[model samples]
Target: MSTSGRSRAAGPDETPAIGRPRDANRDVAILDATLLLLTEVGYDQLSMESIAARAGVAKTTIYRRYRDKVALVAAAVEYRSQSSPPAVGPGGLRGNLLTLVQWLAEQIAEQEIGLLGALFAGMRSDPGLAAEMRRILRRDEAAMTDQPLREAVKRGERLAPHAAELFAEVAPAVIVHRIVVAGETCDERFVEHLVDDILLPLLRGHPNKPARTERGTGSKGTRS
Candidate 1:
């Protein structure tokens, strides 16, 4: 009964022989409701019945489209993030890094820290959810960092051989550390300082610097 792998736009309309056509609007409603509930109730407290009530749909509709709560939550997160991705970084490594860092700060500030805490807990508790979240975040991180770093190296910039991994993680890692651990605000000033002080140095450092032993240690730096 799971429609998990079906295309987002491919509803029951595609299969006339099936029961009543699936409403794309209802799909949006469900996702929107799920996201709202996630923010308001936290992942552990969120339930399909609650989402159904918020969305004005039956629990069966939710189950028909998603395999479980984890799938539903993952879909909702993806739905929202894909709709409003951080703007693509501009030219130059500095500019690109600043852009990414600033955007992350803005998003974290806008959503507030509590929601992020809930996300962190949810990801830690559920393997399936964690994997899906990591996959999307890694894709976005690569999109932001890879081309810019490559271009910087081509532009006569002296970058470490592992700059791609190390430098790319700077902004997101520091931002999260500050917000979650240090209890600091992630603002424009914070982002600028991060880009200027930490990221640039790492990128421009010698390749001989000690590297992190674990491959996944810093992957998906941000919790997107």
Candidate 2:
């Protein structure tokens, strides 16, 4: 009448062996709270105590998920960049790239002054945070860049030899110029100039794809 191998109740100490289900809600809460704090005070100012208070979780929870402030900040940036759309489409390659670049610009502009100041300050104070920032930028941004290049090339449009790297720096350049030098914000016209005046012309001259095919429909760069 007794169950030999089939136990209905799991032992308390055996939970680890069974591996209790991870709470998706808790993970999301932690990530959301981290991003909120990053946007509010940035990498330099965020702390475990503040994050726990903001997330309404305990310090142990924060520590369990992340090692320190650097890990937390990295997670936050990773979450935001991941959540954002890689591209907005239906307009074809040019339109898609344009839309995506505009989106990138807006995202950067949203955190313009605060981001610059905080990370710059953090680099001087915390080496781990500095390294984390670099990793997040490199890894997360490369995600969107690779696909855009392929789509552009497939449409008979030439992708610049270093399109990904070039595009990565473009949005931030305008932000730096505006917030640091010109003391202003970038508008749609500026983004258009970067895409039309700069990025497009260079790609056309590349050996793979060459031509000024407006809107990227009729040209069909060899169709991958």
Candidate 3:
């Protein structure tokens, strides 16, 4: 979660003028500063001037890289997301999902509650930020589940229609609700319950049961 002293090359969209490369160290500094300020003061109170001062860069430097706070914050969020550990597990649908849920829980646990609250509030108040956040989440959801679902199909397991879309909403929603709204811990037991009791049932049509079909059978199937 801490991005201090970490540097990455600027993405294609962030490229600077010819022969004038963007400083990777400065990019890290600015993103780190933005995240820190966001946690402390929330999006409404954060200012470009404050970020520049905190990052030890000129205001124009930030403006040159990002058009405004919205773009800067989105970039910071994307950077943090990219920095997180990839969700990998043993080769099985259930095992992969368990790893994904655990990975998501760990990511959420690393964030400051104030930062979460700030983001929730900002989403309510700023349409642009909300859209950007949703887009980022959707992209991540696809990345996390694509392999597992595809592997399941290869194993002759039939997924309900729209299974990916349904799965994308369930685990994160429940985990975030438990931690952020119910103010409860998202421990191992909870993750297991969510996967075994809820998600598995929804996706596979029954707990611990694989959805398989006989050849040339016209059996009705469930949509995930």
Candidate 4:
């Protein structure tokens, strides 16, 4: 449906509504209108007036659920994202992180460049939008420890002192940097390099060197 600016996705069957049940079909119609407008007009050009006209719902109906532009945009982003909790399992740090990164890659490749791209800029003027973006990023960052910590505690890995800061900051930071700053694509190989070369060493209390081979080298089993 929409992810507003967050990297979540909603299937066409989902609604952008919450807090109470709504006229199911009506909400879906409004969201369909929202997504269509987002794709066609971009976020800056999107307006409540356009949503009303597109949905055949009065502006009052739209306003009744969403108090302002920020709320409506957030709902649409969450809707399209089908925002679900991070996958949790005994796979520990590595497993949890892989799912998290894969989701980020997909969202950037699929949603951010299309219907939701403009939401990124909207954050400049809207604090709520900025918070949503941070919330989405933090979920992945915080997930690194759930199982890993449990396992480390069992084996008495001591949880290394700097580990907390590293997990919560570095992995997400690189991905964010690559996407938001360097404009690099987060392909599967890159994620693998990050995990094998970057994350594993940090977890083990080693330097943050992720092993790598250049573009033309033969594939090796080493990290990167």
Give the candidate number with the greatest lDDT. 3
On lDDT, the stronger of 1 and 3 is: 3
Query: lDDT of each prediction vs. the true structure?
Result: 0.66, 0.60, 0.73, 0.63
lDDT per residue (tens digit) for residues 142-222 in model 3: 776788888888888777777888887787788778887888887766776677667777787664653232211442222
Over the stretch 1-224, how does candidate 2's per-residue lDDT look in tens digits? Answer: 00012111211122242356756677677777776776678666788888888878889866766666776665555544434545535566667667766666666655546645666777778888778667666765576566767776777765557777776666567556764677665566565555655556654444333334563454333311
Model with the higher TM-score, candidate 2 or 3 = 3
Candidate 1 segments whose C-alpha is farther than 4 A from its true place: 1-21, 83-91, 177-189, 206-224
* TM-score per model over all chains: 0.72, 0.65, 0.80, 0.66
Task: Report the candidate with higher lDDT, 2 versus 3.
Answer: 3
Q: On a 0 to 100 scale, what is the lDDT of residue 34 in model 4?
A: 83
lDDT of 4 by residue, 55-92 (tens): 99999877776776666776666666654435456655
Which 10-residue window of candidate 1 scores lowest in summed lDDT?
1-10
lDDT of 1: 0.66
CA shift of 155, model 1, Å: 1.9
lDDT of 1 by residue, 1-224 (tens): 01112225322222342767778898999988887888888988989999999999999888888878887876776565532333435456666766766766655545546656677789898887788778666666666566777777778788866776785466667776787688788765566566655677677783343222211343333322
Better lDDT candidate (2, 4): 4
Q: Which candidate is the best by TM-score?
A: 3
Which order, best to worst by lDDT? 3, 1, 4, 2
Query: What is the full ranking by TM-score, best candidate first?
Result: 3, 1, 4, 2
With candidate 3 superimposed using the best TM-score fit, by how many Å does residue 100's alpha carbon deviate from the native? Answer: 1.7
